[model samples]
Target chain A: MIRVDHLTKKFGSFTAAGDISLALARGESLALWGSNGAGKTTIIRCVLGLLSFEGTISVGGRDIARDGKRARSLIGYVPQELAFYDDLRVWEAVTLFARLKGVARVDLDATLDHVGIPDQGGKRIRELSGGMKQRLALAIALLGDPPLLVLDEVTASLDVCGRAELVALLGRLSGQGRSLLFASHRADEVTSLAQRVLMLEKGRVNAEVPVNQFVAKLGAGSVLHLHMPAPSRALAMELLRGHGFAPTLNGVGILVPVPATQKAVPLRLLAEARLSVDDFELLSPRDASLGQENHA
Target chain B: MSATALETREAVEAHAPGMISNVLTLAWRELRDALRARSFLLYSLAFLALGLGVSYVSAASTGSLGLSGFGRTTAGLINIVLLVVPLMALSTGAGAIAGDRERGMLLFLLAQPVSRLEVVLGKYLGLAGALVACITLGLGACSLVLALQGGATEPRTMLWLAGLSILLALSMLSVGVLVSALARRASVAVGTGVFLWLALVFVSDLGIMAGTLAMRLPVKSLFLATLCNPLQAFKMWALHSIDASIDVLGPAGLYAMDTYHDALPWMFGASLIGWIVVPLLLAVVVFSKRSPV
Candidate 1:
């Protein structure tokens, strides 16, 4: 459990996180949702006790300033940057992190297997694909099975499949009763993993609500991604457009913007046309990684 | 203890540190990073090449490729190690901290349960490890060539020179770590390291030479001033060990011998150790005060 009271962070004259107070209950998953420069990272940094802030913060009841080592001991962190060391093998890096975190015993093989990277222990970090690197970062975060996990932009660099797989793993973690505090701009990730979403705007916690209500209240639309074989791409786009939806071709598949009100209509139209979607997720409007938001 | 109690105890132990273990782990990472760095390797190899060149040249000139030839090579190899070792140490020491900061590695490391002092000490020791390895490789290669040519007599003098050079490298590494901690950017940190090297190696000597020519200070004062620069103190100490009446330090050594009597060697040794300690403590202070962001 993490508790932050009146947390305010400032850089000279500009406030990064202003008067933001929130608490993440034990075994309760919470997500910080914000656009760029919205103080999402500042809030997380404050919770991690990395920044000088005006407030009280504690992890598992121990104050960060008074007992920082113990407070940090209760938390596992996955930073935004996936770099540990380029030359170290995947398993070696994990072992080093476990030691660095002072974890008494961690089954490196089990940790790697937990992240679906069982054999990457021998492979160098630089040799890993983006997905594997992210997975390795997660494996490192899971060391000693710390009670709290703080992940910053977890799906920022992953492809759709990688994102889905990671989201599923996180969902399992959520179900197993580990406190999760994640920061993301992706509404879909918030919906899938976060039980409660704290919407931040300009260093302020503007709203805190359940993910479904948060998306519904904002009238934000979700983007439907259709993954078909190359030959069926044109037919799917035509079928989508015929239903008065805007369709765009991405590298992997065609993306159709579906508003919350008419979300059912588009999916039914796709079904009616027999254009199969291999996988799909209701992408929140601010899912910046998937594609640029369409204001039009 | 019960199973849950045992788990709690291990978790508590994992978070607890009086700083030694944390520093060692960090130092190990630092050593690995520095040894793999191309700049550290390049500077070390340059020292190595100089050592090889000096060994064979001294052997040829002495007309004896034995113990006498190896002893003679020390005089020339000392200068090369003095110049090359500091540069190599700077690259590894300053580059390690600055690169970590720039790449967000420091932030990640600090986010763990370790304290700020642990990070600095770990990095310093790691760089020291790399520097020692590099010094051994370079100076050892030259010695190996001499031994191969049947010259193995003056091991004591050879070792003394190598030891002083290691001390010299450590002194500069401390300065480099301080620069790396204080500077905001990696490029700036490296630039400061180079400038410090230039100041200590070239500028200080040139300034002293100019001042001495202009003012004509007393011999004792001049001698004290020369020892103020670690490189000069190191050079004097290395050569003085071989020839007591060595005129390499010009008038300072001779005059100091007469005026200071038994205290001159102690002064040189103290100055070299001072150079190593002062900057390193300053680095620790700065690191402890500032956030690792």
Candidate 2:
């Protein structure tokens, strides 16, 4: 549904994204996986034709540079920032977007229902929770029933449940034969929704992996910190070690470095060992580095 | 790319709205927002009070509340329009793009299929509509009072002032949009708007007067300088409509009358229209040239 060729975006002396190329086939879903400042959003912006970049991008066979308005007509974009006029009621906002998108007819209730925000038409935009706001952004993106959806870290601001719900909704949408090009750093979202994953680092595409093998290749990039009784901590470490896991102890907890996808495995092992975990925290690669800094 | 993945150009174009539709939709939103804002209510009330207050005060000398003709009421309201209208226009227009950028709303709007020119034109029309509403509310109430009190004489003068005031508001609004498009933040746009207001209303006049007195400048130079400021251009026209001699404008007015002769009104009228059109076109160009980032 989209193809990017040798795309490079630079801001003055700094390159935000460099020589990244990828494609998404019709009805297929892909994720740009990277940490913050890793060029995922930059690549997304370039694809959306929001930035001037070297090389070329074509959406639905139209060159974005030469035909941005029509090329964008095929896309429904949900930017990372869920910004809207605060004083406008939900129905008014949706109607306005519908007109902008050239949706000839608007069934406000149906669109809201699809995004799980039915009956929110009377509420002001300012009164919505983070989850509802994200849902509204999605609803706005879905206007005109565009074939492709370009989402930029849409669930970053949502809580755990909100993220899960949105991801499931996206999965359903993808299942219904809509192409999705989304940028996300969450392993679960990628595994659940994307058919392919493009790993990004330092403004370049590091690797492209099939979703099935993505987690195994990502390695032990995340860590789980289990805060247990001091006596049980040693046993937890040993038990985790026997399970082919390497564990270390920090000041307040036992830390086991694991692939993000295997976060639950360590907990499952502790439960099998009957070692109670008082509390636990899962640190992604970025937070893991911060954890190391604190330990140092 | 697979054939199924690519949509035909015609198919894509079918989903996109016409430019006029986009502009009108955006304009409607801006107008609605202005109407709902607290500032709009405050502005309307202020104009209403100014209208009533000016008419009553002007007629007080005649021992009645509405005995003063439209000529006197317009004469009394001209200075307030010169002062308040630009400030109102600036406040309304200065926030157009910059405020949206601050709130990230511009990104959402731009992400749609609409062009940059559509956004600028739409905002200008919507904000201009609001300003017109404010002017009409105040002046309409004043005219009604005059007619009821049997002082509706010189209605043409009142209409002329109303037209000139609206023109001035629109001209200043164009400048404000330019400021909004140039500034990255709302606060900076506001500061620029205020600075422009001071230069047009106070600093420019004082500077020209000072320069003329200190350097023995020609009447033509003084006249040209006055025409360059939209506020001054408005004041001269408003005064001319009330008193054709334009004695209130002093030497520059006399010079304009002597130089332009029969075409003086057309010249100043075109100058005021130029003030409205020139800045708006410049704003559209600058806004269209902005990087999408």
Total backbone collisions for each predicted model:
2, 0
The alpha-carbon lDDT assigned to residue B111 of candidate 2 equals 77
- The complex in candidate 1 yields a DockQ of 0.26
Q: Put down candidate 2 lDDT per residue, B1-293, tens digits, no spaces.
A: 42334445313333578889999999988998887778778877887888778876665544443324556777788977887889889877898888998888887777777778889999999999989989988887877766666664466777778899999999999989998998888999988998889888899989999999999989999898888788888888777766776666788888888887678678677887888898889888888666544
User: Distance (Å) between predicted and true CA of B186, model 2?
Assistant: 1.0
The most accurate candidate by DockQ is 2
In candidate 1, position B53 carries an lDDT of: 92
Question: How far in Å is the alpha carbon of B226 misplaced in model 1?
Answer: 2.0
* DockQ of model 2, rounded to 2 decimals: 0.42
lDDT by residue (A1-296, candidate 2, tens digit) is: 78888899988988889898898888999999998988998888778777778987888777777667777788889987689899889999999988888887899999999999999999999999998998999999988888899999989999999999999988888797789999999888999889999999888888999988787776557778888889888888889999999998887788888874677899999998899999998776688667777888
Q: What is the interface RMSD of each candidate, in Å?
A: 6.2, 3.6
| A216: Cα error in model 1, Å | 3.4
**TM-score of every candidate:** 0.84, 0.91
